[model samples]
Target: MLLAKVIGSVVSTQKSPSLTGKKLLLIQWVNADGSLPAQDQIRTEIAVDSVGAGEGEIVLVTCGSSARRVFPEPNDAIDMAVVGIVDSVSQNLSA
Candidate 1:
């Protein structure tokens, strides 16, 4: 899983049957410290919203095969999915 911010939404008139009713969101990758990446290094992707995450909200993204498991149809053609909305994140700086 990775942390990201929902930047915008995607609307497609035609989509695969499995993705017909899913909400697609544009998300930008976020650093573990909660800072966004440099402008040049910014990476954005489209993810299926499984948790009803809204734009500007911090969300948890699951990628690869694991992303498909969240839907009722496990074979859904999804490479990424928003699994959770983040309220806060904590990490130990010292190792």
Candidate 2:
């Protein structure tokens, strides 16, 4: 899983059969704590919206096989998905 910020959305009139009625979103990778001014990751990417995430919100992103399972069928062509809308992130690490 990864933390990402919702940049915007993608709208398409014509798309694949499985993608019909799905909301495609644009997101930019963020730090685990959801702080912006990202560390070398300004580029935006796309993801299928599972939760009702909106622009400028911090979200939880799942990718690859895990992303495929976010749906009911689990066999769709979804490579990435926005699973949760993050409220806060807290952690303590010792090394």
**C-alpha root-mean-square deviation, each candidate:** 1.4, 2.2
Per residue, candidate 2 scores C-alpha lDDT tens digits across 1-94 of 8899998999988876667788899999887766665557576889999999999999999999899788877347789999999988778767
Task: Tell me the lDDT of candidate 2.
Answer: 0.86
Clashing pairs in 2: none
The top-ranked prediction according to lDDT is 1
Cα RMSD of predicted structure 2: 2.2
Candidate 2 Cα errors over 4 Å, as ranges: 37-40, 93-95
- Cα RMSD (Å) between model 1 and the true structure? 1.4
Q: Report lDDT per candidate.
A: 0.91, 0.86
